[model samples]
Target: MSEEIGRVGGPKNVREALLISSETADRNRHEIYEFGPFRLEPAERKLSRGDEVVTLTPKVFDMLVMLVRHSGHLLEKDDLIRSLWPDSFVEEGNLSNNIFVLRKALGNDREYIETVPRRGYRFVGAVRQLPPTGRNAISGVLEGQIRDVPSRQTRRGWKILFAAAAALLLFAAVFILRRFRGENSASSPNSPHLAVEQRLTSNPSDVPVRAAAISADGKYLAYADPTGLYLSQISSGETRRWSLPKDFVVFPRSWYPDGAHLLVVRDPKHPLDSSLPNPSLYKLSILGGEPQKIMSNAWGGSVSPDGSRIAYLSHTNAGDLWIMDSDGANARKVVAGPDPNKGGAGQDLIWRVVWSPTGQHLAYIQAHYRNAPDPVEPISSLRIVDPDGGGASVVLEDARLGPVALWWGREDRILFSYREDPANAQRNYGVYSIRIDGRTGKAIGPPQAVTRAEGFIEGMNGTPDGKRLVLWRLRVPAQVFISDYDPGTRQWKEPRRLVLDANENLAWVWTADSKAVFFVSNRNGTWKLFKQAIDETSPEVLVEGPSISDPRLSADGTQVLYLSSSNPDDASFPAEVMSKPIAGGTPRVVIQGKGIGNFQCAMAPSTLCLFSRDGGDYVFRVFDLEHGAGRELLKLQHQVWSENGSWSLSSDGSKLAIFLDQHRIRFFSIATGAAQDVTVKDWPLQNGDWGANSQTVFMPSHSPAGVPVILEVDQTGKAKVVLQGKPNADFGWMIQSPDSRHAVLGEYIPTDNNAWILNDF
Candidate 1:
């Protein structure tokens, strides 16, 4: 019997029985099976309870089908495994895992599949099979019975049937109407507007606004634009600049409920010093008075709807949420951050906490630790919990990189800003809203996009009525400039703008001959590699694609290596390391993985190319371009922050410099798997690259007092300022020539950020 069951060709009687069973199953494939309120269709591979379809994995669905095929009969464990995973070997644990997942997908109907202890499983639920026209046949018989009886119950049934038919007709009509309107809106110019935005403050001097807030009554707006705090009245269109102490810098965070006082964060330490004063919260009055300190060590805070208590974020090992009385008393931690001692998984940092309208719940952002097997991407979730730290749950699990600003609006919805393309900084940021589940503190409906605007929406606030919104729009213009740096004199001179097209042009590298420069730009809508000679004004396109980044020229100057995304718009697309001839031809893929960034090749002495792949921690590899192979050299002890741009390769490609957390720099040798830490007096390093001698690294450092300076650090970590930026000017990434005599730096062109009020949002 076992042989007959397993063999394809068997005895005549057995073959006939098997063929009959197969034909019967095929004939009933499209038939609907009903058990209780659940319905299953074998042909569609779908299971539904009344109107909602339940999602299931492919294996689980197959297992459910097998169980239902043998309903009321106990199937042995081995038989079930053979039936489900017939072609491969699988552990009993996998079967059990699938059963568990299947039960979860079944929800309340999980009891239908009963586990027979020490043996197998059984589908105990009584199921009835129905033909294609079963419902219509039953309805026709009911109509005949009702006509024969002519009772009140029959009349009531007829009324219910008519009502349901009307409802179905109405729903179909509405769905068609919505589809028609959507199609027309895509092609029509006179479509209905969803939102109207108006710019509030236009500074003639082009000072970029940092943090902004609107008053509760929507009558006044306060913002910081590098200089100081400014207050503007919406009704009068008059602006007032408030004076501050010379040593203190204030960033407006939130406005007091009373509308007369604003909550601000102050930094009082000297900008050039290495040590900074702890950020403190204060109450600055709009009526012009000395600011009064409220909290000793807090940066962001939000007041309750009743203005009685405040929820604030305090800096510890990681940011944590805290609650305190309005007068700064009875402070306590509510949401604990990740512990430094506990290494993997649950470690998360909290940021951007905001209170619900009734102050019953607080929503914040949590960044989780990077896990292995997947690429190192920024993993964040929007979470909500009780103010006293209870009933916590994640509302949105895949929040992208941005400012993490969230505002609770009407109808229990939260509006937030996120970036769709983490690789392309030039892409527009979008705003989305998700409905909050009141009972479980989770998100209920799908997130709907409100708008996608150019640049970034840094800060957002809503009026008391939740009808008007104020947002800060920031656009930073980046351009490449060539300057001469003399390592001997430690002076920078004759800085000239290299690219004048006004789009973001960065990640510039010199060719082996130092005659031309190669960089990545998004001037043509998609990120592509472009090259131009040192003396030329125009750049020629080298490689054009939808998702290309981190361009590198090989040591022989014959090939250009870069990371290309199969689908740039899809975050799950794994990036591939591709190499193409510098002169131009078909590109060849070398390595395939996630989180591929920051690659370099030796200038002339060697043909080694170094690249880094990020999983949880960064793994650096050295690839021999000639042999088309590579090996891992070292892995970082900690995960590199994606936004920091922390790793750099030396010109000779012998040593790699990595800036790690806790103000530490690691100089790793490629030949030997040895690393040495470079100590720089606890100075925070932004971004830098190696000098021509390969012994010193030139990096940008900002002082505690917010002063930006270019520093040259030796192999031993001794550092000295090579170039000082203007007091308030922001310095971007810096790249140098092979001889260290010439370099190009990104100096941010001043951009004016204005606060806009969006009505009917």
Candidate 2:
């Protein structure tokens, strides 16, 4: 039977029969059956409830079959359209008309099928077969009835039957017209809370990380959504706004110094136009005004405390830091000739200038790409420099740390962290703080650490005019807290929990007013941006849309920009970043069509590679939530390949390490197009990522014993075993926390249905 089933390319007859019921002739039943308030007899090609006949067309009958067979599953509108008219093209309105007819046949019980917003309909109802009389008795009765009908028609009964038929037709004609009008009214464009939903795996939400950053005052939030940036208000969920121009691909990177404006980055013009510079930084006002371009050739930058100067990393292969005026003038080189002799020409790239709280000094991480002729790790370091390009020094040099993340306090102190390696082939970042200027450098807590674990440290304003400190801690479900400092004790107090169960992560930017946190959450399974008090219940959906990501609230919380997936039903989940108002209105698509399909995001938001317009090619696209467009940057022609293409990135977005050429692992630098081979022994390299510092890359190697091992290496071509063993440990998709303080591994126990996270060890 199994062989027969396989040969026939379908399930066995026994299984098929079991799926249905007995008594009904196998040949009499159609491919699909619908039995509910309305009994549709496909062989008779009629629909009826009890003795009352209901009129329907052949196409509508077929639609009923499709909906019933897959009852309780959301059926995409496109799928239904194809199923009904496989050989012929039909207008969308035709499908709608047929649905109206079907619903009329069902009468007031049309709720059996639910309409999901923006997608399709789902048949949700109870279905059961009718009890049968004795088989022979039923068959004999049906046969006699069939014979009687023919004989009666010959006995001059035509006149009476014709009169009845006329009345039935008249009733049906009026009923159908009314039903059509009713359906149109119900599906009005102005319907509130309407959303298209489908129970399909290939839909949106496949991407794991969806987050946004809110500023100190919490008045605005900045998000890097697949959609465009959005601004929502806390006082009254009344208005929502968008942030973007009509054509440019402008995504929100970070918030401005005052939260009164957003830091928007414009993506490269096009991949073919290599002359087009990388995304430049600009300041977009929350209240809406002309966007002031600050830097034209910078990838990532930050606003100085006074909001007068912008510190950014140049996108050129030379990789230098430059300080520019907020209005896009008076640019000065902050870091000159980083290994000038090397000419900054390699896969390894340095990053942005971070100004100290006092704005007196600047800091950045420098990369020294180690050419791994074989399986070797590269080395990198944290280099501090003056904003005027003076007094340069290397604060920390380590191959494993990757790119450094620096957090500045109001007291002119800089907090930096390093990770031992990328965790679990995914990313398990850890957290630790070191005082800049080579003073009081120590691991904050749980100092007895063998490896770095995942943690986060964000600047939260303290009481008494920003004299105190508030920091945020994030794992899978992120939370916030206030970090109390004791100068005499030289330690941070146990933090106070601010908000719990953040759903996903922050998706909106903080407002300059410091009163609320705006973000998007799918707690209800639909991505919508919201804003709430810092300690209030989580935010609510600010706008109505399908699959929104990368939401950045304008500094004043008046506008929002985000990338929204319009057609989640598409296999590729084709999306266009859109912009709307905080007050909520029609959203305009800023970035039109480009990518061929959806690419799973394995890297952090820093460096993302989506499917390019050209098949088999990938382009670095910055999803501008503010601008509602994804602009292409660097284009690569098949440099890396993956069946699933699951890979990871450096914290600073400089490098990408993925399984290349199938079994062997490879590392590719985003800046220099440098590719190298990594030494992967007995275990095949499945998934991995670069350390926080970007120099070292970690790949998961599973031994013959079925134990997963983390292979670690240094630039000197030295290799060593870091963490190995544990056949049951599924760390293939873990990630190192941003601060490099902790690593989270995916632990799945098949026996007990246990699949959960293991935090910092």
Candidate 3:
């Protein structure tokens, strides 16, 4: 079974590696097939209905042959794509277009091609395989039937013999053509194009997939999980843990030409840590033992085509490109991040550096975000350059380009992940490919999507044989649940899901009257704001069309406020902070700004609204309910990560609680400009928010076991666990009503990735 085309050596080897599909190969009985009024000739590559030849395009003809060959059986779309386009992958739309054209040519009166919905297409018509008409069959049938030989034995014998000789010659020619060109044979179900996908592991979110790589021979798979690094037999699914020195976390990155050793990434920090430091590159033997350190603080050292040198990234982001020997010796900088003077956007983020198939050029993705701190409006460019630091040029560049990773595949092709649908990129991330001219090292045409599915294809590695692909899809599946706070018991009631649907959901704050909760969900594909009443089972859609998030009530409690944009990840879109009257009215823009990180508002009569934007550093802005624009409040010069520098407005609109660090919190008085610092006991806090009374703060952190925990910090620096979520769940945010009668908690769901082996993809 062929799987990965990206792993193959060259186009010459690719063409020879793929042959007549098994399904059609074994059925090539040197015969003609017939169905209804149509007669199909395999060796002739022609279809005729009562002598009327049905003209068909080459690709369309190929599609019809496969469907007719596997009549009544579903031909998977992936398999068909592989068969039709053996070298380059295209979007499913291309396959649909071919099918539509084929149907039209086949006279669509009867449902010849049946689409199985999300699956593949099937040919429902009955088919008959007619035996080959040879010289022997013709002589045998007619020789006995013709009793009267026109009263001349010599003439009759000569005619029969001549006919037999011509039939024999024709049969021999047909047999030879079928062997070389595959005639009308379609790819068999077992062909690489139709390779079946197999899941190798069923691990949960806690033991997420670290990394995976397929061997060149397509016989073994090297991967890393929470347990440890493992080597698995592809055919038997027999996986064995590799015994190595403990303490450091490790993940398999790529394979060496020898296949006995693998390039691995070793991180000294704990794998379960929320934030991990940079990892060092290492070379580990599959035979087991200690891994040898290759280079420190580097990435991408996969074996070059000739197994001489490697191109690696000096840093993870905005890093210089460097090439080093195979044994980690004689390392030197080959290329640095894009220059700022040459119309370059600051430092170019170098991602997924790979050596071209022939070791002629090095391919890499240069990317930059409009807002660096928060990574908004990502502009990615696929560029390649000579390893000697010459012949540098951009192959493809797009403002909305966000590929999971890029890989130079077989046949001078590069495979990368990108979203097809711009509106809802969350579920549309798929693998795409583009062919490169071997001589010029330039793209031949626009990129085409090869694989499309839900979740993110975080990692992909194909076998060198171009027959198998290793897929690692990552997903963070979460749902919203309401946990009521009981002042009587000073505890939270058992949480009940806010929305019954299975889609991911998150709640920010309750409605003005506290009778309902406004939350964001991707139930209809894109993230939208919806209000769910506690008394009702269904939620009402409050905002749709544009992507919206962070649903909160205005400080005066008379309006609903949310951040809406065309593309959430893109900071250039300029998110509009909109508000609508709770009693029902068109939403009006309060303020719009590019690179808005997040926004929040205090309870009724407080009029304390704050929004943060991340261009390079974090900047805070404040606005009132009646104001159309906001005034800059505070500008943070220091870089803020996911957790550090978290802030929240107080319910009384008198102060702001901000996390100066993991263990420190600062409360700034709004009017007097007074500040008070308080220290907490939590070792690491993601963020902190002000409570209803404005005197206490809640800090969110995760336990080592991956459970979400919230810490309640008092003015005296004392802390206690207020709310802890279930296992494999995240604590999104915490919100309390102004009355303090009840509280709403956002519990994030488990997130995990699956390792799959797709044959012949």
Candidate 4:
């Protein structure tokens, strides 16, 4: 109902309201009723969701009012079609699709409009009806009326109403909190943490060793520490702390889909500690129980959809056909035996394991064969296997395709990420999908590419309905966006910016309306609550937002919530946790931990807040930023020394990708308590970019003896030289362009003592 100013000014005055109503009165076809929380000037056609301007296609807005005015009646399919498309011939399906799309853009308030079975649609919510007031009540209000309005309510009555409103708000908060927890199914089988860190200066924080994972029920999240594990409650502010034995180093690897336990990799000594001893995987628990050893050879691990089994790649010498149930008593090899070509070695070097949504098959990575550590190893291919462990084969492989990501869905279909390089081999990766059991394990091509430039995919969690695919893309400095994955069309819609600001780090939640995005941003210098209309041509900022990151939208999209800092100005550190409205209003702080930097926050599928506590030690703590009850999952002895580690959470929140020191990277499984080094030997210099899918890392590598070239690495652990020319090329200073279409090569021209942008190779 709020009106947007063309530029910037105060609220709309009485004269303007009168002018608007009078102008629309002549064409008042059916007494058009337009009103919301504050006020709106329909005739001006300018709408505001608080202080931000909401841009909308003219038609989308028109459709909105038509439904609003008809507040409580069903508008049959044909009935509305006739009114809207009177002059044109359109199909019923088209009308239905348009209505559906419009609803998505309008956001959660669509509750006012109800879907009426096979009949049509109805607007059932209350409408703030505006009256003509013959004498113009707003502008032409008499002095007596103004006096009477205030006199009607005494100071005490006003106080009572304010108190009642506050109480009701509190009750509503409780209801919504319970609803989200209950609906998301505290035990839903998916929990992926979205990690966002901004490298503000020339020097970035040591690549963060942050780890994230979700409980089998999607409620609990386990994160890594240099020394231990931290268990956090996703919905309620709750947490439990776990410390690894002093002698045995532990790191989380995977979370059982069952949500009750975890699988961790425990090493008597660090595997990278001496770079000789092999790492092993062990199963851990969150409900407080003894850990059981799973595999001595397992590294990058994954749990099956049924939760009865596990899969992981053994050491290079061990066969890689994907050992299943590698945890339980019935554990055995699942995929076919290793490839015979390489002396009957492993069949795949599994990076990401996507269990079929319907629980039929699995898709994983098959690293390429290499005799030496040349930076030109291509991706082997994608391998699909059944749970029973036998019908396994390469589903996609080509000279151009590189192993990126593999995600399984209902019909044994696999959604993967790869790059298409016709020749030079500097192929940039993008999102794609394919059926595992198709004809030959050849290139069937991806349905849609998620990113154009070398963008990294942070989180890709499918919606409960399986219609929407939520993803996070990171460039430099950082930007958060949302894209709609429509399986029916097999096309990925262009991604829309979720958070308005581009320079800051952002994490968000999507409501029912694809456009109404609620996210947390550092636009205010510190993280804060911010909401915008994803559908609106121009989104309006709902609230100033709290200093929080990792925001999750309720499944229905009605609420925009997130964890807030326990305190805004502790001076010691960030606030604990808090939440507020996506539509912009007051915020409620939920958790207040002493000496905690509330700024450390990550949001997985579960709505819990994952934050870091940096002080005496680098601590990863999880709590329902809203309810304030959770514990620590793990802590690392090296956590304190590590500064800028980029932490990433797996979709299921079972695995965490921690990039410590731009060159050293590791993946810790929350389930296995195992931390495996993903760092490639001599991985160029420091600070480059995270390739598409997040798994593929792109960093400028110097060919010590040859030309200085930029190398690209895939999830398969294979690397390829992407660019080369000048010796000692400003590698660390090189940056990706805004459009990502071109990379800026910052070079200091010795002749002129000036820097030039290399537009030409």
Please give each candidate's TM-score: 0.69, 0.34, 0.70, 0.36
lDDT of each: 0.69, 0.48, 0.68, 0.46
Q: Cα miss at 380, model 3 (Å)?
A: 2.8
Worst 10 residues of 2 by lDDT: 1-10
Question: Compared with the true structure, what per-residue lDDT tens digits does model 3 show for residues 563-626?
Answer: 7776666545688888988789898888888877677887756677888876656777887667
Q: lDDT of candidate 3?
A: 0.68
Q: Residue-wise lDDT of candidate 4 within 212-238, one digit each (tens)?
A: 454444455565543356776644536
Per-prediction CA RMSD (Å)? 21.1, 28.6, 12.4, 26.7
lDDT over C-alpha atoms for residue 126 of model 4? 51
Local error of candidate 2 at residue 728 (angstroms): 30
Worst 10 residues of 3 by lDDT: 1-10
Supply candidate 2's per-residue lDDT for 84: 67
Candidate 3 C-alpha error for residue 639, in Å: 4.1
> Which portions of model 2 show Cα errors greater than 4 Å?
1-213, 232-241, 269-277, 337-343, 373-378, 410-413, 420-427, 437-761
What digit string (tens of lDDT, one per residue) describes model 1 on residues 178-274? 3322323254554333343456776533467777788888888888877788888876668888777776688787777788888888855433232
